[model samples]
Target chain A: MIATRPLYTPLDRIGWLNTTIRCVLALLGSYANAVLLGSVIAITLSMPAKDATMSAIMLGFVVQLLAVIWVFYARTLIGAFVGLALPATAAAVVLHLLGASL
Target chain B: MKFDKPRSLRKSMTWVHTWTGLPLGWLLFAIFVTGTLSFYRLEITQWMQPETQQASIYDQGQGLSTATKLLEQYASDAEFWSIGFPTARNPLYQLRWRAPEDKSGPENAKGKAKSNAKGNANGHAQGNGKDKPQRGSNNGHNATSADTAAKKTNAEQSQPAESHLAKGADGDKIKPQQGHRGMMQLSLDPATGQVITPRETAGGEFLYRFHFQLYGMHWSIGRTIVAIATFFMFTAIITGVIIHRNIFKDFFSFRPRKGQRSWLDAHAATSVIALPFHLILTFSGLLFLAGQLLPMVAGAAYNGDPRGFLRDYRGFGAEQAAPNPNAAKLVDISAIALDALKRSPAGIDSINIKRPGKADAEISVTTPEGSLFSGKQSLASLQYNGVTGDFIPATSKEHSAAETIWKFMLSAHMGLFTTPVIRALLFLSGVLGSVMIASGLVMWLVARQREREKLGYLPRGHRLVEQLNVAAIAGLLSALGAYFWFNRMLPADMVDRSHWEINGFFAVWGLCLLHAIVRPHLKAWREQLSLATALLITIPLLDPLTGGNFIWQNWLQGQFAIIGFDLTAFALGLGLLYATLQVKHKLAKAEVTKAVPPASR
Candidate 1:
């Protein structure tokens, strides 16, 4: 849904700048997303703090990996940014509501 | 920036794989190659200092007697004494000890160990309490080995090589050691328990340390760099799998002599074959640095003090030493070590004696490494009463599922807690991983061959890649070969001898980079590979001629580690030789094609 084919079919070229921006967005965005995701898991889990911290960290790795792929897999910049930002925003809000001090 | 149309996912992922894989691929290659070689870190170290070859498997009775006698003489007043038995990995029994803080000479700023005699000495072990995540798993995950392993890299980087101080020459003050917190290590012959001064060679410790934290930089910096690369590597692997499009087919498929396709085929085959290993190692590698990489997880969870998480996770609470004036004769530690070794399949890694001479003294004997599911470095250590020498069974703690999985990954990455066969397999898989990275790098250059040919010249960027590939791949091998050569060439009595060995390694690597920059790309590859091949093939020769036991002697003694080290060196040499010849053939073929018409038709 994020990728709409532009009407002009002849202008199909990938620019280095676009790719770089995409990379920066993906790495930083995915990282931000993963941290919040991990923090949430660490707080919400009903397990021991040590176990929760370790497990959340483990899931963080997977989340970051998937977020990176999603950024690249998306057809547009808006799509990539939104893909990471939406989840990250949700995670942050949930973290706040849970009364966990950041 | 010009906008590009939305591309297919496959195309997009290919770009991701290419960029992520290529830019940092050289660094990754170094990490992979060294990490692979580290599967036999102890064996290689054993081979490097042939003097340690006299050591054989631990004979609990006689070995312990000798070790006990040495400890009595050398470190009687030590706050801590650690004795590590000879396992299949490290055939030498290693001894380490720390002077009490109050006894630290010169405000502890100038801690130094000056051994009474000349021989190979191990210094700075990986401190289990710190630098856990930054350590290579193979650094003898046992307490003693960890300390031994940790201090080794410290010796490589900062301090001059240290030897155990002569009884009368003990310094008034000693500097704190790195890794295992500045513990001093001595190599003891398993048979006689006499100290064997191993040559100050680079040993396997240099490469093992280099693989994780690099050299010549603060460990945290080097570790962070490695961590970042590992993150990139994880990204590459996921993208690689996504972009593969035919993972199962790639597993079964291999194409040779097809240039770009051949390179791609090799990459795919190796990647698919060792897919599980790559995933585990990369992720576990990340987890090792997880405390730093995602401190927020610990910070948020443990109220901002990450140390709290570490302390709780490691189960290390302060143990106050009981000061009992009553003097009791300590029982036989050898028996305890042997008994514990039998019960714990990992074998005895280290025996730490705290307040060793007093009635309330304690002896904790740990197995080689932690269990697959336990968070602790040792699954359950066998403790003994210092004065009475009574056995103390460890209270087994229940492991949660999450902790179990987390610990399992960490233990698996350490590559301990396994039979020799499994270690060998891991080594082979590491070799495959190295190949996978190498081929991927070469394929990138090969994929651009057409553009170069059409332009009749190499672009600046392409030329840069060419030089890096040659230097990082064949050149690194050459440097490694030189390190072994230097180990043999350097005199044993040279001060800071192992440091000299490490210096030779960097020196040769720098020379290789220079050579790569100057020589023609193909010739450079051929030359470096030839040198590596020559060095590797003849490494086994140094074993006997350079004071190490012969392969046959090692075999008769059941020291397969030495034999394995020799044969592996020879095999790697032969592999490099094959690669060299291939490059030579390509060089010759290109010459012919250039001489002939551009197109015969």
Candidate 2:
């Protein structure tokens, strides 16, 4: 086979397991972070309530996309997890302080 | 850069692209095909309902008078009436009126209302066929709910209004709906003013809804599934770009007949060509389904009842006096239309009355108009008092920057603001997007050839993937072709004819899947695609043979929508034929290679 090995996958059991974890992180963790980011923007953006919510919701997808890429690109699983968690925690705290319900 | 890490950005992205794209590729392909065709949903409907095609050669005065007569005779006691006059795409003289609440039977009302709602579903707001205008100022979340709230206040459906009180910003949402609820309709021949009951086919609406909501199952669940798949597609598109090492160089490169390389090149070409459209459509699709996908985003801010957020997002409350049910003659629609024409000069498209037989009724004469970047089409409309025939000045709200951005993205996604030429380009872009997805899916199978060959024969999973490639790609096309044929061939008055046509689509698609599983791979591709080709090529003939005028005759009548649909189908069929010939040519080469052994090589 004269094909290039640039896109090769050396998926041993541990690597497969690692990929699986990242996949979950990309889907679930990213979404958790995204809604938080969106909520923060929706509440805090100085525009009208409707515009703020809309702009935030639309921008949420971009945040989610980046989070997915970050999950795969992170050096370790812990790094990926913490990257999402820290911001989510911060946003939750802010919303809580602002009397946002849930 | 030389860190001893397993992570390579390009490698991971390439992996992500494949995994995310492959499983959802077939679903995305189906969505693209249907959504692309939905650019001409109204046109497809016009073509499908040929009984009204040759009847578009009448004057606007006649069209309005017929609607007025119909409404006066049959719908005197109705709540509201909407008249969609003869237009280029909407060739039928449409008269829709909501029956007074007590008169409407639940069972009869749901079917009749839903079937007619299918017309407004696509044409009125011009987005995803759902009642919500993507970004219309008269966005129905503000108007219809307010209108429905006035009616349903006695019922329990008025709970969304509690959020309005909490927000206190809805002081401008008094817009009344054109029509909703148990609305009955009449589609008359505009040329002769005769009743033209077009056959009950799902028409383009089934495809439009199925693209997002899918079929058979509960709509919310279907919408969620589509949303998740859409997110996966969005990820794949971005990663696909990241993984393309020489994206620019590869974009222009094509090596035909080189198997794997050719597929890759085709993938690259299609992806690069329609990159902007792919991104816009995928992202906007997520936003379209966002309410289901991320309710928490809106919920978290709006006290876990996002109705407040939705109300504001769709814009706010303006109070208007409700119709008192006191009978009063409606002012002449022709006079209102003439006044509206004098005001706009571009001419009126529809006359939607809030209360047809009441003194306080409002008449809105909407023109076929829009600025492409501003918002959805049909923005230029004049409202009038129903009895005194006074023109009601529009309380035009200034669009916020945020709303403008939202509107721009939405209008671009809907392409409702496009010229005919632009619409064709958007459709072409969608076709390219579909080809991109299919080629990438095929490349996954092709690139795995060495691994399979090294195992001496195909593994079960690889075999399944091979069968799916045939079924999902060519087989889906075959189903769509069969759907069109069923629309022509089915007995029009047969009960549940539309459902039968859709079922015929799935049934043919299921047969193609069975054939794929049973036959050799190449043979399955050849047979299904050839069937699709044959079916599509004869669509032009079907138009004339099955109760439609000749293409030239339609041209004479200025009924260009059907002519356009027929020509487009023929062109698509030609393209498919070319693809079929290529597959057959490949099969021929395989046959020759097998005839001689490795000794010859």
Candidate 3:
């Protein structure tokens, strides 16, 4: 008997839905991570007072790092979400402690 | 359009990729490596020059005062005394003075028209008797001679010796003086006018030169090459992005198994992960030479004034006019400027005196310590009148928003302003960048190994590539390690000591390549790598032996450049050792698996 198989099996309906939910979660996580990291950087750089431009740069760097993490683990959507979000949340909390208004 | 066969298109595209990348792959690899290292060239200099280690912590007040006094005394008649403040990488305060009439003697001269005939057969070798009679006939010449004789006889006059004009090969009167370039550090005693620091040649400047100007080429040629390279690099990055459709997927997909597959995976991963860095670096490197490449545009748009373009990009006023020649006069209160600088809230780093003591002379103050790249392009400056000590009405845009952004970008690129943590991060990224290249090179070899075996002759093409791989990947590192060894081992009193060190570096590198060509290929790789690893690890040990501080002390004292060099060398050594181990493991496994028949193996 001859056997034929694919390396990756096609996703069932439930599997497809699960993957979609995970991917959406991952995207949200990445966004959150970026905001949080940006906030931390903004707070650290905000000498004397908080400013808009420095905040923007911080946001950009955070976004870049988040994108890097997300892209690498995107196939494992949930893993990507967790990997990105943790850094973001941690940064946000740290910034809050450091007296960032936002 | 009709639908095309996807398979044929893919094959053709693959071929295009291979052909495009293969030719410049090694050159590109070297550029990336050296460029990364060059980011911290100043720090590297500090690490290598142990003499600088004794310099104390930066004291702005003392440094400024010292500079003020020094400049007032020595550069009082200078066109400009551009003082460079001490930093983490360079502890010594450096100053440049462009004075009138070539201040130093002929000993510092670069080239000389050899005195072909020591004595003239007719005692007219230097000048004929007729010319001497003409000189005697002139009363003005007699008066000048009498004044010079009186000055020589004076007990108090500590002025430099009078220079006698020499006849050149063409019989043109030549005023032979030191032809050496850059600033000379004057002696401690203000009146002496002697050299104290033995005059350091600009080695770091050469690295800067190499970035734009390659060796064995004129400045124009080098600049054109650099400009073109910069332009193509920018285009390459964009094309690379277009080509890497699955960049994300390849980021973490490193597989160091057998030959071709491993190299491909390594290349993909390195090329993908560092995309942002590569893009920024290539663009910025080009941007540095923008004026050279776009001279026409700059000239047309900015009224043919290069300063106008600089002002637009950097957001600053034109620097104060350079002082006119022969209008210099030493001012009183030399300490005043230094005091004012020290009192500034942000703190002062260096004080540059342009055309010292002249009416048009300007004193420029700056932030002293910064990243190598950032320092080359100053962050902030305030200019003042040299004679009056009045604040010159120059723009302080260096303190402005746009200028600050430029400084930050420069700092980020150089891995300086962000703290030690960022430098370490960048260093790791650089290592990954190197690995990516190494694996790619190896992959090419593996891919063709089978073809060579089938052809009965190990093809010359693959062999050449392999030889280059060994030479570049292992050879460069070994050569650099040897440079340090030579620096320590060569007798301290050796003449032209630094040049010897540089020569030693190239010599070792040349020998490594020679060995690669002569020896059987695998042994060359193993031996060179193993030896390089040993030498690298041994450098830190030699530092302590040479009476330099121990690694622990350097680290604890926050001597980052010093400690960093040792740690970097140690890490590289370990890396090479690891690679050697991998090679051994693979060879052993291949032997065990009997992939080749007993007769062929």
For every model shown, the clashing-pair count is 27, 8, 3
The reply for model 1, stretches above 4 Å from the true place, is A1-14, A98-102, B1-3, B56-61, B102-180, B317-329, B338-347, B368-370, B375-378, B595-601
Worst 10 residues of 2 chain B by lDDT: B137-146
* 1 or 2, greater by lDDT: 1
| CAPRI rating of model 3 | incorrect
Residue-wise lDDT of candidate 3 within B1-601, one digit each (tens)? 0111112333433433443345555655555666666555556555555545544544443454455555555455545555555555554555444455443433222111011111111111111111111111111110111111111111113332322112111132211111123223321211221122321222333333354544445555665666555544443345445556577677767666646766777777876777666656655554455445543223222333433444333223325333365565544434535554565655454555555665555565654343344323343345566667776544422344533544454445555444457666675676666676666566677777777667766667877887888887788778778877876777654555556666787799889999888765666788888878988988789877874678987776556677777877888889889977876675576578856323222
| Candidate 2 interface RMSD after superposing interface residues | 3.5
Please give the ranking of all candidate structures by DockQ, highest first, separated by commas: 1, 2, 3
Residue B180 in model 1: lDDT: 36
lDDT for each residue of candidate 2 in B1-601, tens digit (9 for 90 to 100): 2112565888878878888998888888899899898888778766776655656565553556766765676567666667766666676667766556633333221211111122221111111111212212121111121112222222222232333222111232211113234445556666555555556666776777678878887666887899999999999999988988787898778999887899899999999988999998888788767776777676555776555565444332233244376878878878888788899776666677866777777777666676555554235447788888998786666777877767677777788657789888999999999899889888987888777666666677777877898888888888988898898898765666667878899999899999999888888889988999999998889889997978888888787888899999999899999999998987788788763222111
Worst 10 residues of 1 chain A by lDDT: A5-14
Scanning candidate 3 chain B in windows of ten residues, the lowest lDDT window is B110-119
After superposing candidate 3 on the true structure, give the runs of residues whose Cα lies further than 4 Å from its correct spot.
A1-102, B1-17, B59-62, B101-180, B186-208, B226-236, B290-346, B368-378, B392-420, B423-427, B453-456, B555-558, B589-601
Candidate topping DockQ: 1
The 10-residue segment of model 1 chain B with minimum total lDDT is B111-120
Candidate 3 or 1, higher lDDT: 1
- Residues B1-601, candidate 1: write the lDDT tens digits: 2336646877877887888899889999999989888777767777776766665565644566766766665556666667776766776666666655533332222111000101111122212212222222323322222113223332223322223322111132122223234455666666655556555455676787688778888666787788889999998988888888788887888888988888999999999998898999888888877765777776568776565566567543334344675666666787777677677776766677766676767777766566667644453367777777778777767888987877777666667566788887888889999999999998888898777777776678988898999999998899888888887888765656667777788898899999999888888888999999999899778778877777888889887888988898899999998998998898889777773223210
User: What C-alpha lDDT does candidate 2 achieve relative to the native structure?
Assistant: 0.69
